[model samples]
Target: MKLSISRYNPELDSRPYMQDYEIALVPGDHMLLDVMLRLKQQDSTLSFRKSCREGVCGSDAMSINGRNGLACITPVRTLHGTVVLRPLPSFPIIRDLVVDMTNFFQQYHSIKPWLENPEPPPEKERLQSPAERERLNGAYECILCGCCSSQCPSYWWNPDKFVGPAGLLQAYRFIVDSRDKATDERLENLRGPYRLFRCRTIMNCAEVCPKGLEPSHAIEKTRMRMLHVEASGELDTHTPPAGRPSITN
Candidate 1:
């Protein structure tokens, strides 16, 4: 089997280039990450990211044959010929097949991924009914992989202003939580010119998600929540409650 991987070294190469390598494949060898590890064994300079060696951790996400996916779960046999590898699109490359994720994490953090409860703490864990918990089924499965966000055109164009699909999906995760007390504030935060409105419903984010989660759906739900808030005349006087931290980027 042959693998053509994108390579870049800030210390040497001024631009990225593709390098090809030949590998012997066996019946047991399937995942693309395995092939990458084997290639690394031959050349220690080759660099990429992988953890858990499974899809659970999205560290191995890259553009495989021009499509974004986790290398750990992609079967090599499924690829027709030489597999082409590149870093996630619309992100600054740190090195070979590894892109800087600072902006991605910052957008995620801006949405406040954690639950926000203002009520007094209960003695035990905050309990949610089975039906209430089911609302988070798809949204909670996201692994923070850059696939969806990188595929989003709005994010590509406005990486700084737009929150993108992954962040919106997580925003929905906290907004719909039955125990969360900051639903209004969460909706208020996203009600901006470039934040939630930038989504054009292209569905690219949903198509490229490795987790099969529909971030587009989550984004739509968020838009609907925004509409509801607007219809209720809440935005005119909406303010983030005290103690809620502000996110700059």
Candidate 2:
């Protein structure tokens, strides 16, 4: 396999450069992460993040052949020619394939990802109908991989002021929750011109997401709810079914 990976060392080199390597792929080599580990054995200085070799960790996200994806799940067999690996685009490079995600996380934290319900809790637990629970399906699967935001042109321009796709997706997750009573506050917080409206609906976020989640759709739903086109309340239309109490209650 031929690999061209980005290499950077702030203390030693002033600029980053692409370093090439050729290695034989063994029969066990299935994913890009496997090739990376084999390369690391030859060069101890190579740096990248990987955890839970499955796709859930979101730690191994990088640009593969100009497309952002997770190394843990990208099949090596699908790669053609010299595979190019680079850090997430537009992010500050910490090292080779590792980019500083401080700003990314700060934006994520700004949205308040946790549920907010100021109403008095029921004697046993807060409950939701099956239909109400279904609202969370597409928005709740975000893995915070930074792939979507990194590929977004809007995020690249206003990373500081704009809440990126990943953050807005999480914002919608809580905004649609039936038990959450802070829908008004959440919408108000995102009412800023740059924070929510900066998104150009480029659909880059949906294209790069490893989990197949659509942050663009979630953002549009949030915009509609803010405009009063959709109801933003504790949608308790159906009777609650007998179920286990929520641990978050």
Tell me, by lDDT, which candidate is best: 2
Using alpha carbons, what is the TM-score of model 1? Answer: 0.93
Model 1 alpha-carbon drift over 4 Å, by segment: 237-249
What lDDT would candidate 2 get against the real structure? 0.89
Error of 1 at 152 (Å): 1.0
Residue lDDT tens for model 1, 88-177 = 998999999999999999999999999899788899989999999999999999999889999999899999999999999999999999
TM-score of each: 0.93, 0.90
Best by TM-score: 1
Tens digits of per-residue lDDT for model 2, 139-175: 8888899999999998999999999999999999999
How many steric overlaps are in each model, in order?
0, 0
